[model samples]
Target: MRTAYRVETVRAAEAALMARLPDGALMQRAAAGLAGACATILGRVYGARVVVLAGSGDNGGDALYAGARLARRGAGVSAVLLGARAHEGGLAALTRAGGRVADDPFAVLARADLVLDGITGIGGRGGLRPDAVPVVRAARGSDAVVVAVDLPSGVAADTGAVDGEAVRADATVTFGAYKPGLLVDPAREYAGAVRLVDIGLGPHLPSVPELEALQHADVARLLPVPRVESDKYRRGVVGVVAGSARYPGAAVLAVAGALRGGAGAVRYVGPAGQAVLARYPETLVHAGPPGRAGRVQAWAIGPGLGDTPGVDEVLESDVPVLVDADGLRLLDPAAVRARTAPTLLTPHAGEAAALLGVARDDVEARRLDAVRELAARYGATVLLKGSTTLVADPRGDLPVRVNPTGTGWLATAGSGDVLSGLAGSLLAAGLAARDAASAAAYLHGLAARRAARGAPVAAHDVADALPGAWRDVIG
Candidate 1:
């Protein structure tokens, strides 16, 4: 798992580690790692034109010191100080190593092979300073590969919010630990590729992280595997209430996802029973209300359930439930809060915006906050689906899980319906709500990537690719 800490916690950890080490030792270690990364990016450092954008902060110092190291390695390094004053010690070292302060920042930036952005640290809130905007823009317009120091300037480290002008890096070299901003969206979009530099701050940091992204091994551990003695019922039965007279395809797609989600048997109830049976004869079909559906370990409601009246019945069940699509529109916060069993709500940006009574743009801008708020309000685990799927628990104590695997090709009709069924199946298998949501998202995104492979893919293609993704994880 890739874990991220808040800025305050990271700052406290850094301070504790710095106290134990000798003066300037920590900064030097950071500079060494930064320089090594820069050198690696610029394969042949000899005569390479490197430009450093330094601000009046420790981030600037790290960049300046790194510039000195590159200068010693035969790279022609120049510094453009953007702040009122730069790090005095770092500036001196750069000059000693044959690096010069650039007289024309724009002229140097235009010709540079690589640009190091240290214009603002993680603490920077609103955006870049007025004076630094043009210089940052010039660096961006250049053909140079821009690398941000610690974090891209102008993004909130805690919330991943970008209020104004921000640096868009080709890659970011963050030290010690990953910031929440580096993992969450809006800010995550600004940070291209991220490389973590270890400065030995691990021992000093807290055990619990603010955010986490599951890797293949982590998902493998969470996935439910069948035993020799296990029967269909023992494996887990997922009850799916989806589809309608107008849109029967949603039921077929949702049931497809459920079947691939490791469930033993799927009992689908709705008007689209004939369509579902045509696609998947294995499914146990029912005509009316989901309450009459035999026994199920979990219930997956919503999808193409236009004006369907099963949300209340499913919510009343003791088993875990997953609500999505049209069901989210008919959700009652009071009913969700009243449930004893766990409930997972899956909502896209537009759906989420409607639930919270805010603009879709607002939810897109502050995904982390929106998910957390919705989870708290409904007293249920909420999965906000998008380019980066986020799962937030209602208690707000556990770290929000971020799905790292995905492609833009996932933005298609009925894709979310598939996710709803997959997550619902995981819930039926007895995984905790948070684990179920996160694991489903991980698999969903991986399957989409496998199915698309740089081409367009339909929702069923993603569902079809689930087994391959499952094998890849547990293999």
Candidate 2:
């Protein structure tokens, strides 16, 4: 799992390290990595023009020392101080290395090829102060490639919350571990592309990372596969309780995802019963309710059972139940707790807000917190869907799994239905609730990327491409 840490904790750790080392060793190390990234962007270290937006804290010290390195290489490096008093040691290092200091920020900024935004780091409290606002705004409006030190200034480091204005960088080069804001949204959108630089602070970090993201290899290892002797039932069976005469397409899309999923058989129960057969003839459709849907390994409820009633019976099924979309609207917290089988709740921002009784913005701003809160409250694996889809199970000590293979194209309607079906199928296949959800989200996102191909696609296109995605992962 890839992680990001908070700035205050990082500062405290740096102080501890400094106590054991030479006076300026840690800052020099941070400066070395920062300079290397600058060199990479500049291509030719000696002739490139670099502008450093220096602030009052150690963040400025990092940029200043890096500027000194570039100046020695013959690059015309200039420093613009946003604060009244810049780091004294860093300022001297820049002067000694022949770097120029510009009193007029506008004149230097207009000609730069690259901008290093060190105006604020983890320690920065508010948005760019009134005076520094134009400096950052001008750079963002310009064409220069911006590289932020540690984290983009003005963005909260702990919660990924940006209450005020923040810098939007072309790339963010962070030291030690990553900060949660870089991985979560709102702030995540500002961080165009993220790169982590190790400053040897990995040993002292906590076992339960505040946030975690899965890479391709990690997903490849966790994905389940079939053995030669495995039978159809041995693989898994997912029972689907969805659809009403009012919305038959929901059942079709849900079955589309489940049938193609690794599940051995898909049993459907609901009002739009026959419509599920018309679209997915393979589905074992039944009249009445999900209680009479016979035997199955897992159950996925609430894709489109709106106001038709009798959904309570389906929700009580003691199997690996996945509650989603329409089901989320009428769900009772007490009924959810009565199930003995592992349960997974897949909610987008609005649904999560309804489940937790908070505003949508609250769920979006603190997504990591919202997801954990839902897991503890519902006592089920909660999969919060958005830019970084998170899967957390309440029964285990597992950290939430953030899906890294997602694109904005996934915002299409009915995409959530496909996800619930796929994940529910995996649950019946005997994987842990977290594993089922993380695996399904990865494949669903990958399928969306492949199906869209830079264009818009319908929900069925996503399900149609699942086999290709599964093959790409397993083969």
TM-score of each: 0.99, 0.95
Clash number by candidate, in order: 0, 2
**Model 2 vs. true fold: TM:** 0.95
Poorest 10 consecutive residues by lDDT, candidate 1: 118-127
Q: What's the lDDT for residue 174 in model 2?
A: 89
- Backbone clash pairs in model 2 (N, Cα, C under 3 Å; residues 3+ apart or in different chains), count: 2
Question: Top model by lDDT, which number?
Answer: 1
Query: Model 1 clash pairs?
Result: none
lDDT of 2 by residue, 380-450 (tens): 88999998788887955676677878678889878888888899898888878888899899999999999
Q: Residue 291 lDDT in model 1?
A: 90
Query: What's the residue-level lDDT of 401 in candidate 1?
Result: 90
